[model samples]
Target: MRKEGIAKRGEKNKTTIRKILNYISKYKGMVLASVILAAISVVFTLYIPILIGQAVDQIVGPGQVNASALFVILKKILVVSLITAGVQWMKNHINNRVTYYVVEDIRTKAFNHIQVLPISYLDSHPSGDIVSRIITDTDQFSEGLLMGFTQLFTGVTTIIGTLLFMLSINPVITLVVVAVTPLSFFVARFIAGKTFTMFKCQSETRGAITALTDEMLGNLKVVKAFSHEQEAQKEFEEINERLAGYSMKATFFSSIVNPATRFVNSIVYAAVGVIGALFAVKGFITVGQLTSFLNYANQYTKPFNEISGVVTELQNSIASASRVFELIEQPALKEETGDSCVLGDAQGYVDMQHVAFSYEADKKLIEDLNLHAEPGQRIAIVGPTGCGKSTLINLLMRFYEVNSGTIKIDSMDTRKITRESLRAGFGMVLQETWLKSSTVRENIAYGKPDATEEEIIRAAKEAHCDSFIRRMPEGYDTVLGEDGGMLSQGQKQLLCIARVMLCLPPMLILDEATSSIDTRTEQKIQNAFAKMMEGRTSFIVAHRLSTIKEADVILVMKDGNIIEQGTHQELLAQNGFYTQLYNAQFAR
Candidate 1:
């Protein structure tokens, strides 16, 4: 079973590499130019050694030293050197440009695809894992591709050019180099196969560390409150050590390839020198040819050594590329069909008829449910945790499609309306507030990017956030840290509320929007919300009973069904679950 798993992984990696190569082929023009320039450079460089050998023969071959001939040969060498330098520079420039642009395209596509990915995919995966594939893995793949482009043409050309020269001088010595070349290939392949697995593990471990860092630091307040720093540190240490181990093992194996190849090449080099001398003594080969052959033999094997050194980095690149490709290939949310309706001028009427849903297939959360809300009605949903309150909100917003149900908004099936258009009609402020790193004014005006300064101030005032904005050092212009870390929880919630207020959507959903504020501030915000909710349909999910006492209709939900729903006074008169919950909050 273990062997079969490893074999399967190897096959998958091979497929990933093929896909990456196909992706690179999209830039055929730049790639062809890079190859041509690299070929020119290698050919020019190889000509230098031949010129030197000719110069040596001119000066020392059974005649008075031919100074004129040697000088001409030296001049040719200089010209070749200059041309090789120019071609190499151009090749590297094109190679790097192609690498960066290809990586940028992949990164952009990956980021955009993730935006339309199913919400369930995001819920199941850690953010760090997704982020690692976007940033770190893409970087590794680009670096490897750049290295491959720079070296691949030169390595192949150099080997072939050197081998042909060696053969012309003497087939016997050329055979010696050829016979030993397989040893280098064997060593590289053996080590590289092992390092590939190790490097893949290292990449995964690195992502795990990133996830832990995101979790620990993002929740530092909770970690400190619970005095869990020691535990967190220990968990990080274990993950770090495991990453270190994988890295060390990969390094150890990859490092062995270089020396092993060099060892075999050295033996071949020594044998060529010995045999060439014997051939020279018998006059089977000229002294200059022997000199040239020796240089070519060294050149022939150098590419192998260079390639062996790059094997580990290439393996790491492949591992990272595999991860990135896997993410890019993930099944995204289906696109809107051509016939999908575009919602316009919503009336805020919503209905859920015989809705049955579940996050997991077998564990049904909501079943046989029916609900309705008329225009401009305040529908309050009061339920215990995990009773599908937020899930219902998710369904309404199309964050998650229902398992088996039809949700109609303003007399049109939600499935028919485009998600963007349907979501545009509703303003949502959840218990978990989200604020980007930007100025307070920008955060408040997020829902309406073109909101004027006066409009922003008015919305802030309505949400009761203007007073705090005025107290800030830069007022509304003050830049916030990530997720508005510089502000208090209540302040952040108010900014979110202000954003929603600026949009003035026809429908609103507030899931404990004021749960973090003090009672006095809550009362003020409630008054502001009352003014905002005058003619708009709204859904309120709250745990605080007092907040919903005046709601036009209250839904008493347990598990997933609404056991009772009515005006607040009518439910209280019955003295049932609603009364028990309402009295429980005040009984404290």
Candidate 2:
């Protein structure tokens, strides 16, 4: 059964290779021209030895050693050599351009696909792994294809051309060379199969190391605060050691192919020399013919060695290519098609009916859920950490599809609307802030890319972040490092809130958006949010119960189900989950 599974997987890898070839097929004209040029170059190269033999015969067959005739043949060889060089250069140039273009197309496709992938997919896959597919794996594929084009066609043509030439000189010697050549193929095949498995393992281990590094470096602050550097290093070293082991094993197996083929080719060459001398002695062939035949024999077997080595390198490329193909071929989020409705002016009246969802098939998370929010209502969701509070928000944003239910925004089913338009109707501020390395002004204006300087300042002021901005050396023009590392956490949240304020969408979701701020700053931002939420439907998920005291409606939840819900005063009077949560914070 395991062997059957391995066979199926090998078939899949071949299918992936064909798909990669299809990407190359987009540049069919250029690829064909290169192949033709490669053939011409090989012919010129193979004809050189024949010219040398003829020149030798011309000089030796008669008394005076025909200097004029030999010179003419030497001139022809020089011309062919120049032409061969030019054609080879041209072929290489075209092949490289075609390879890079195909790589660029694949990278673009992968990035675009990533943009539309469901949030669940991103949640499950590591950012580093996805990045490896886009950059490292595709790059490896590019190198392989580039070298494959430069060698495979010309090498094969030289082998065939040389064989034909050798047959004309002495058939017996040609047969001997042919018989030993298959030994190289069998050896290459046997070794390549093992190298393929090792290379695949190496690629995965390399990605694992990248992921570990990304995770550790991204959280360096936490690691230091906990004094866990040694632990982090130990974890990284484990993965690094695994990667080294796989790489060494793969290279060891691949390294054996060249010398093994060379060994066989050396034997073939020795046999050709002895056998051809006998033919020459019997007067069946000339010494000149023996010389040409020996050249052809060497030429014939050299490609086998070259191809075997190329095949070994190509195993690494193919392993990487298979990884890239797996990512490209993953099922992306279902796209809205065939005249889906585009949101125009959203009213923000949302409802969930009989909603159900699960991250995994066997363990259901939310089931038979129902919720409704009137336009302009401020609905707050409060619960324990894994009680599906954020999951509810995820469902509303259509980030994950409901297992069996309908979500309607402004009385239109969300699935019927384009996700881009649907998402545009709402502005979100989450606990985990995302800010790129750019000027403060640009980060504020992210949601509304065309916002004027004045509009940007206005939003920053409204979010209570303008005071701190003015204190910075460059104010709004200051360039921030990755994730706005130059700013404090609370200040970063304020910038995020300012970004949302610029968009002024009709609906909002603030999932602990003010969690990083102190009470005074939180109060100021909350006042601004109050005004913003007055005429817009908003959902707030907060761990700090005091923040939602004035929310128009509060839903207390536990274990993926809403246990109680009412206004703050009403829920406090009931003395249930909400009462206990609110009291616990003040109790501390």
Candidate 3:
């Protein structure tokens, strides 16, 4: 089982590394430069100890040693060291540049992909997971890529070169030092493998904590209203404790690696010293040669330790990379066909034939429904909660796919039309209007980003929001708080209506659009709605029959099927579902 688990982990690591490589491919020139500089720096570092050994041998030799020659050698060594430092500095600079650019590219791709994902994907995934992908996952790539490659490359090169030089100096001492290499590697690998699992657990636990916090903060109003602050705090504390436990486990395993490697290294060094002394005393090797061998032994051990350290970091980074790659690997929403139909000068005729849909396959939400609306018609859909009134609008907008049916606009199948073009021809105003924190003019102009001030003012006027907006402290220039917190629900809804009006689409959808406003404001909004729907098709989904009294058609839906359809008066006369619904509300 452990072998199987290790295989799975290795495969995951390979996949994630491939993705990281692909990201780096975009900046090939910079990466190439960094690699070249890193190689040069490593070669110079190895040369330093060899030069020191040479200086020591010359100084201790019987032949006259010229001070000037020694000075020249020292100067040359200093220059080489400076050059190596310069290369290293440049490598770091280029690595950071590449890291930042690659990170930016990944972030942009993730965000853009999220925007294009089908609504069903968002419905299935938590918002916190998505946020973690953008923030935490990307940050991991940034941190790892910046230093992981340079360290791995340089450490390997330095170790190999030092080993070769040490072997050339005295093969016996080199053998003694090399004997401990495998043991060090085994210890490092064991600790790294265990720590990696802990790190993965830590990351998952952190994501859960983030999700819980986001949920609580998002519903702060409800929590406060119900006096549930202590409950929330307790929940948060539980998550926090879970995160801390996992973090400590990961840190403990990581901390063991260095100490274990260092202890083994000390033992190896002691063995090398004893073996060198024996060789020198037996006249098998000279004092100078033994000294050089000892230096090389120390050199080898240091890089070995450094390599072990790098490996630990690399393992942690691989864990993070796996998470990031998993997110990127999710199937993106299918793109619109190249030859998809486009809505141009459409008359807003809509038809649904044998329509069926389900959020999940076995649990259908809407089934075998049929409906039609002609140009310039007003239709209202009414039903109890969970009766799929909103689901119908969702299908119309192609937010979710129809299971086994067809929906057409202006005689063009929706499946054959691009999603952007299909949605472009409709104006939507929902019950909870979402406004960004921006100036009033910016919010109103969201429907038409390039709209002029005059056009903005006209849309606001048409929505009956101009009078109140004009009285605001800064009029159109006022900055709204997040989600339009500074405005009343009625005012926010009005702004949303104005935003839709600015688009001037051929078809309009008002989903409980007036449910938040006062009766007087609802009347005014209804008047504006009637004006806007004068020459366009409209669909109003409402629970209150009074709001749809003037609709040309009323459809009563239940259990994903339409049970009644007719004019308001006709439905009332029939005394069926629609009639009963109306009577119940009127009686109340």
Candidate 4:
């Protein structure tokens, strides 16, 4: 009853198979080419059995054989076998190309869809889980697809071709052969039905283990620091144990399919051999024809075994594809459906009137909130944890939409403005810094990619990171690893600060921008920020009360409401929540 995709439990596999076929249809020319080659290879292969039966018949009297006729048949067999091998190789190559191309398209679309998904979707889903669907599941799907493409068409063609050849020799025996084939189908179908769910469960379990591995590896330092390594390992083993069970059950079911079909196929082979011998004894068919009929029966039954194996693999593939399509089908962030308004030349004025919002509808976090920032003012928001300070920053940047009311920038409704243009004018630095695997200079100039070397150096100097950059072996060109590898937390924070400094947008949002830096370095960064904020409207969200003493306006918030608003000294004089918080931070 478990569901991995948008469809209901019973309908998921069929829907995924149809979608996968749609993708395969995109490369019809290649698939058709592969099919043609498969057909050619099968025909040549089937003809070899006929030639083989003729050769068997020609050796009637041992040394008194017709050597010339036998040699001609042998030559035909050799030529036909060589042709079959060549064509089979070509077909395999085409199948390989088509399978990977389909996978490539699916992967590209999945990744592109991820970029436009809503913030809430990303927030709710684990990063490791998303990565597993895109990477691990996609790979599993490709393996299944490749197996399908390689065997599926050839098996079908061989079955039909061998059947036609057998029918030309004897109708009664062919009917008997055809009747027994259904048993194989029924057995394979019954086993396949049981295996799909297990394979799907196995695929899901693999993703869970991959998610755990990714989480543990990314935060290994934290695990060691907290002495939680053993706990993490235990948790991993439990998930891994489940994965093992699912895999074994799936393998067990799928493995029996070929042998089970072959068991049925053996019955068909026995019926053909015995019936053909009776016909030969009565001289109703020639010895050579009887021999060819028996060979044709064996050839015809072989594809059932192969096809059953294909069914097993396809089940696994469909399960993996279901997981992948689930990601690609997720609803994207609502785009600008109406005419989008442009916010040109932001003048550092922002207003929020009657703004009401919540992460969950039942719980109102920010209700009937109002704020106004005049041009060139420093508005520092001070609040305790969960007081909606960072949430306010998210609203300003339009990371989340307001549930009710309007937030305007430069007197234009923010909802009307294109998100790209609206957010482009504001430079933001959050406490958690992010840097890609690139050079130090590249990280500094991230916000303004085209900034000159002199400009980047000046920004780094202003942000107090230029000293460390010069000491590195490659100076500004030093290649950073993932998330500023080898750099301390403070150094990474400084690089992020330099990024915002390089752009120096019309407005700024700094949420504890200097929390990682030492006191002396923080003072230098604050001085840089002051210069940067001189003519820009800025919203500063700070937990440290000592950081925002000179703000033009201080907003003290509690339980999602701004209870006090004044200059820092005025708030202290009033002796309210702000004073109490300031005292708590400095308390011995």
| TM-score for predicted model 1 compared with the true structure | 0.97
Q: What tens digits encode model 2's per-residue C-alpha lDDT throughout 209-268? A: 888888888999999999999999999999999999999999999999999999998989
- lDDT for predicted candidate 2 compared with the true structure: 0.89
Q: Rank order by TM-score, top first?
A: 1, 4, 2, 3
Clashing pairs in 3: none
Q: Which one is best on lDDT?
A: 4
lDDT of 1 by residue, 1-588 (tens): 988987997898789778877878888899999888877787787777788778778866466789998899889999899999988899899988888888888899899989989999999998988988899889888887888777767788888878877777788899988988888888998888899999899989988988889888889999999999999999999999999999999889988888898998898888888989899899997777777877887888888888776666789889998888889999998789888999998998999988888889979898877899998999999978888899889999999888887899988989899999999999999999999999998899888999999999999999999998999999998999999967999999999999999999999999999999989999999999988888899999999988988789998888888889999999989999999988888876
- Displacement of the residue 356 alpha carbon in candidate 4, Å: 1.1
**lDDT, model 3, position 431:** 87
- Against the true structure, what is each candidate's TM-score? 0.97, 0.96, 0.94, 0.96
> Which tens-of-lDDT digit does each residue in 104-142 have in candidate 4?
999999999998998889998877788888888889889
Question: Lowest lDDT 10-mer window, candidate 2?
Answer: 55-64
In model 3, the runs with Cα more than 4 Å from the true position are 58-66, 280-292, 471-474
Residue pairs in steric clash, candidate 1?
none
Give residue 212's error in model 4 in angstroms. Answer: 2.0
Candidate 3 lDDT, tens digit per residue, 230-273? Answer: 99999989888988997898888888888898889888888988
Considering TM-score, which of the candidate structures 1 and 2 is the better prediction for this target? 1
Give the whole-model CA lDDT for all candidates, comma-separated. Answer: 0.88, 0.89, 0.85, 0.90
